[model samples]
Target: MKNTYFFLLVIIVQFTNAQDYYFPERNESWQPISPVEASIDSNKLDAVIAFAKANEYSGSRDLRIAILEGFKSEPFHEIQGPTKKRGGPAGMILKNGKLVTQWGDTKRVDMTFSVTKSFLSTVAGLAVDQGLIANVDDKVQSYVWDDTFAGRHNSQITWSQLLQQNSAWQGTLFGGQDWADRPPREGGIDDWKYAKPATPGTVMEYNDVRVNVLAYSLLQVWRQPLPQVLKEHVMDRIGASTTWRWYGYKDAWVDVDGLQMKSVTGGGHSGAGMFINTEDMARFGMLFLKNGKWNDQQLISSEWIDAAITPSQPNVNYGFMWWLNQKGPRHWNGVGEDVFYAAGFGGNFIVVDRKNDLVVVTRWLEPSKIGVFMKNLIDAF
Candidate 1:
């Protein structure tokens, strides 16, 4: 009976500790604590950093070369937007919302590839939260009222479908064709180009063109550049650094309310997305880790965070642009299934492990080693 009571008290204390998260102020250095203070094994944490540095992503530091060579198989693929030479392996680990440790140049800004999808996902959530979007399930055509969402298949797509990357939205936007983005390596261009698309919500395809469609649609709904909306509502509220910049392909500009607006891409596949530092990525991850709340402010509603993390029907490993660790192809062995993250090309990741009260951001780590790396890091705690 005494042991049971003691266990209950320990659990209560841990819960309280988890709730007392530290949020950093803008332009202030993030408060850091030793691994021992954070209940992490110091030597094991060192090993994790060594492992990450040794297993750097085997891509060109000159990302323009990486992007072009990486997608050489795609038909007519070319760099359409800005690309930056990435820095070495950089990362930050947060325990109970305070920085536990970091390695490499955490301040250097670099392209974060498809992790921008998660930010795009957040922008959609903001729209839903502000009532600009009536419902996630409502067909997108009803909002935009434009030919972009016209046609039988595309008109059937909903905001929810777009968020899930399952909308199977067809056609060309900003010179990018849906089927030409990342077609199967074995097939000829014509085969993929002419293939019938799966119904919206029935298939989750990782196509940048479809992702840009979401960005363009959101642009119409917000009537402003997404970067501005993100800055005003999310980034500024979270106290993120001003150095971060969202970019779109040079050809992705459109007229909105008599003004031209650039529609950002959902990723850096064509070399446009979020160019940000590791610290800002950590801050963004922490926001999601705290269920969209930063200090006293609820920047993004808890309800939207819940919906964002919930797995979509088409992909158990995916949830509204966030990657889930649920039992599926992407599941990391030995890690809690509840863990979710924003994964990008070139091995950038912002992992949110709510169960462990942890947020980890890694850049330029070898992609395949993430599971082992995360498993080891969690074990240290």
Candidate 2:
């Protein structure tokens, strides 16, 4: 009987210790807490960082040239955007809302590829929150009467479909071909350009052009620059630094409300996307970790975050540009199924584990070894 009572006491203490985690104030540095203070094994946590450093990406090739090589066969328009000098493997891990561990230069800015999709999806959610978008199921053409969304197939595409990347949106945007953005290597140009169109919401394709189309549609909805909207609505609210910038292709600029606005790309596929630091990325993840509530204000609605992480019908492991650890296509080894993350090319990731109150942001780690690093980190808890 005494042993049972002692065990119950231990459980209660553990549960209570995890509550009332810290929140960083705007324009203030994040408070750091030792791993042991957070109830995490310090040595085991060290092992996670060592594993990441050992498995760091070793490629020395120029990122821009590599991007061009990947799309060499496609008829993609050549466009140049800003890219910063990238550093080696760097990251930050936050546990219970406190900075627990970090390595490398967390402030060095680098290009975040597809992770921009998650930000773009957040902008769409903001539109929904403002009532500018009545429903995600409504046809996008109803909001923007442009030719990019016209015709039988494209007209049926919905906002939700675009958010899920299954819209199969057919059109050219910013001088890039929809079919040629990231076509299958098994097929030729003719096969890609003239392929039969699949019904929107039935197929999942990761074409940057389709994502750019979504961006263009979003620009029309906001009637302003996306960067400005993001700053006023999300970034400034979260206390992110002013160094970050979002870019579109050279030819992506268009007149909006008598002012020229650049329609940003969803990723750095053909160059021009989000350039951010790991610290800012960690803060973004922490916001989602707290269900979009930062400090005392709710930046994004809890309902939208819930729906954003819910698996789409076409892809069970994919949400609103976020990758979910569902049972289907993608699965993290020991993490809960509710774990979701924002991943970019070249191994940048913002992993959020709600079950454990953990948020991890990594840059330039080996892509294949992410699972290993995450599994090791979770095991430490």
Candidate 3:
């Protein structure tokens, strides 16, 4: 009789604890809950922050130099967009939709590099939700009839392939070559340029030039600036701050709907992507955490979110530009398979663990240390 009573009491307590969590309101001041209250080890959280600060990117202070050094063999496209002086290690950890802990200047707007791809992917998802994009598997050529989607091989590519980084679309955009951007170390220029094409959906290659092409193609589909599309459909709806901005290369402008519009890049690889603060990023992650719903409203469809995180056939760890923790070679240790994240070049990440009702946003940490950091963080619970 005593054991039955105790079990009932435990169940009641767990239910009450789960009910206590709520979504944050859209405002500059986000409410925070104590780590103890959220059932997270305060000591472990502090250690994670300390480890991030101690081991940051020491490669180069000058981002342009860093970019050049990272892509040594590629022909340089002089950076035509803006870059800010990056802040120190910063992060925010949210438990059950409330900010549990944060470190450094979380408001500092910094270059998010490839994290922009996730945002770009969300914009694409929006199109799908609106019925603008009929289907993911539908050939991109059906929507975009330009030479960008032309040619025998390119026409075979689908929207799903582009989202999965498996399009294998060969072309030059914004003065950058597909082969030159992150070419394989084993191959020379000729090998990269003349490499035989793989079937569109059979290979996964992370190329920013191809990503930019997707961005450009998306612009044609929407017939408006993507930033505006995002603001109306996602950001403004989520109550994101006005400080965040998405940018494209200087040469990426095109006349759209009788107006000159600049097509944004999917990342800051060649110096233009989303410049957003950690707080805004947290909100974005929260939206995904809730499966594209904010509060009582559904901003992006739940179906779209499901497809966005579903593992691509070619790369089990990648899905619609978002990284997935799946049964694959690149799985995140100690994390749930349902966990998905937006990762950038400089270790910027927005990790969303839906099973645990958690979201972690980290900036400027060493990329290699992420697995250990996540392992430690999960163990703390």
Candidate 4:
């Protein structure tokens, strides 16, 4: 009798833990919980939101003006795709997949610069899951079958290297030169152009041209538009609204399988990436927080999510496009090192804290204050 009683107790505990997560249904309002219900200090939660609002990103709301000013130092840099005027401070805090609090207009769609890289990473993950690409460590040149990855240096890059932003691919794509994108501040155009390129997988460099190269290479592998692949595979599975759009440069089109398709950019550095609302961004974060499972279906494999957040060989705080909160130069002092996030320019972030079963999505907060903002939010629990 005692054994049966203990078995019942175990089942009750397991069932209660399972019920803790609340996945919102498609086309329905996301249910929100009070700070008290979520076991978060109400005043502290309010302070976190207030701090986010006070430290609004100082860049121009008109991203066109902001992009030009931000990248003016880069030689021949110009907005090549589309730019949208951004809304003011907006965010959503989810505890155990339920909305705990939100501030500003969470429904407003806005440009999500390099945060798009995380989504692109997901696309690559899907390709691996579906067996389109044989392996992450395989040379990208094998799949691309073009001059893009033909040269000695470029041919050495692997899909993993490109995802980690250390491919050091030397070339121009979509009118943006890899060397010219965020070139060393000390160098002139000729100096940067002629400098010896770093070997692939040896260093991490943030360059949109190389990121675009990843997008383009993936286009060849999939033989279709990346946005279409993402939409059909990820966004729709997660019940994301149809509003978000991914874009590449105006001239980034190519003929694949006898059909014209525009290859998307992995970021908005040259002015195009993902334009998405905060709620959808939160959903994406929640998907990762749950290890890529949405309801009963595994939208993306858990193995891919694990590999995506694992530290790359070159950068401890960087993984396959996603940013890690590992103990490094970029570490957030008081935050859990296990936390990983999708970050972008102009203060966009989708932070996933698996330890706390939390997903925090913030847009347009001052970028420098992010560490402190996260520290404060964590303190509330």
lDDT of 4 by residue, 52-148 (tens): 9999999999999999999989888888999999999999999988989999998898999999999999999999999998899999999987799
Query: TM-score for each prediction?
Result: 0.95, 0.93, 0.93, 0.98
Give the root-mean-square deviation of each candidate in angstroms. 3.2, 4.0, 3.5, 1.0
Q: Candidate 3: list runs displaced more than 4 Å.
A: 1-19
Worst 10 residues of 4 by lDDT: 18-27
Prediction 4 TM-score vs. true: 0.98
* lDDT by residue for model 1 (19-82), tens: 6798988988888878988888999999988989999999899999999988988888989999
Each model's C-alpha lDDT?
0.92, 0.86, 0.87, 0.92
Scored by Cα lDDT, where does model 2 land? 0.86
For model 1, state the Cα shift of residue 319 in Å.
Answer: 0.7
Which has the better TM-score: candidate 3, or candidate 4? 4
Off by over 4 Å in 1: 1-19
Best by TM-score: 4
Q: What are the per-residue Cα lDDT tens digits for candidate 2 across 1-381?
A: 999999999999977764556677666777898888778898999999998888776554366765666567667546456555478899999987789989998888788889999999999999999999999999999999668888999899999999999999887777787887778878788988899988999988888888888899999999998988989998988888878889998878888888988999899888889999888898899889989888668999998999899999999999999999898867877878989999988889999998989999998888888888898898898
Q: What is the lDDT for 253 in model 2?
A: 82
